[model samples]
Target: MNKLLVLICSGALLSACAGTNIVSLESSVKQLKDLRDHDRDGVIEAREKCDNTVLGASIDNYGCGTRKTLIEPLKVDVKFAHNSYEIPSSAYSQIQRLADFLNKNAELQVLIEGHTSKVGSVELNQRLSKNRAKAVENVLVENFNIATERVSSVGYGFERLADPADTEVAHSTNRRIMAELSHTVSVDDMIWTIYTVDQTQ
Candidate 1:
């Protein structure tokens, strides 16, 4: 009889322990679920220092939006000789400055605009302008290691002249290559915006 009584008490203790363990396990699971990312900002609730972040905003590891400055309007003017598309060695420094700027801002892209004087035929000027733009683009891509996809070239020909006067100085000024850089940057406490303008225009 005593043996049977002891066995009944042991069984009860085992059942009670099992019930306690099940409840504890459920509580632990609930706590884990609660610790999951509630805001869905790629950060978990346990480690997230910032809460309620704006959707699609660029963020750091701490779940905080990163600060960024708008890139200023950049214009690089590279002069070309009359009826020539060759980039002069003197222009290398000017082109290098543009390349340095691009290397610093990896997200920015540049547009090379080529222009010509009215001294040549319309078709020839157009082709010459295109070649001039391409020449600058090649130096940026090949010599400076800038990505080709980030640089683009376009020819304006004599359609867009810096000086309309029919003088030697005006013609020299008109025959030029212009580089325009632009990109949108993410700023903290504000929406992503693009603030760069074509200063050459």
Candidate 2:
């Protein structure tokens, strides 16, 4: 009876401690909300805070900081012709812009995602998508001289369609590549990776 009583008391204490943490988190979120909503618009814009800061640097729950290092991710999409992994010369500008951003932010890592329209065989689409991603990756590494280790590529095939219509325009829209920038952010001593757009001008 004595041991059972002791175990029950310990469980209650642990539960109470968890409850305290929940309340603290709620309070902190509220405080951040109040501080960030400066224009009374009830929405916190990225320009209002250190939302453009760098990766691995210390930041608050709302991304405000005493000193921010990294900016947000800059999205640059490169389009492709149907059933082809060969990057068009027209898409070179987008790739160049991405290279410039990567060069400026050395600590930032990039993920180049390849996608295809739903007009080819599944296996063929998969291979083509991977190749498309690789093509972009090569441009950054070989042409721009960005480190290979800093960039990685993935192929999603036609599984994810940007447009579901059965029209040429829609298919053209689906046949493209997506570049996403991400970094790790810490909150309450816990670290998590977050993807945010670069709002800096």
Candidate 3:
């Protein structure tokens, strides 16, 4: 009887040890999985604060994207001849600079404002101002390869003058083209290669 009781107790101990081993194995597997980087974002799952990050995007130590909000401003100075809507060759350099800025910020839009002096009749000045604005817009679209939808032009005929005085300097200053490009955008803090999957095939 004593031998029989001892054999039963030993069997029970063996079953208990098997259960412990199974639990231990499961725990080890869980730990290894937590240490893996499923997203391949340089951070392990155990330490990752963000999940499913975009492939090849710049990320912090916690696997979160590092993006910055920036406000960029651009100014263009173009002078137009009296009673003329032609864009001067001298202003090409200024327009090129504006073009470069727009190309850098592909999502940005520009507003071109054309102004005229009060020497001509209001009707003539209005038409001339509008034509001058359109001239600049055309140069930007045709010569600089800027998108038509990204640029807009408006003419203010002697209404919003830089100098209200009826002097030669004031008139010259008033007859000009003004452009401003400003926008807020989120940009990656660091350069990274973008990965894309082609499905067209």
lDDT of each: 0.82, 0.74, 0.81
98-149, model 2: which lDDT tens digit per residue? 8887887688888899999988799999999999999999988999999999
Model 1, 118-170: lDDT tens digits are: 99799999999999999999999999999999899999999999999999999
1 or 3, greater by lDDT: 1
User: Best candidate, TM-score-wise?
Assistant: 3
What does candidate 3's lDDT look like per residue over 167-186, in tens digits?
Answer: 98888888888998776878
For residue 36, what is the lDDT in candidate 3?
89
Instruction: Please state every model's RMSD to the true fold in angstroms.
Output: 11.9, 21.4, 10.6
Lowest lDDT block of 10, candidate 2: 1-10
Off by over 4 Å in 1: 1-71, 182-201
Question: What's the ranking of the predictions by TM-score, best on top?
Answer: 3, 1, 2
Candidate 1, number of clashes: 0
Q: Model 1 compared with the native: what TM-score? A: 0.57
- lDDT of candidate 3? 0.81
For each predicted model, how many residue pairs clash, with residues at least 3 apart or on different chains? 0, 4, 0
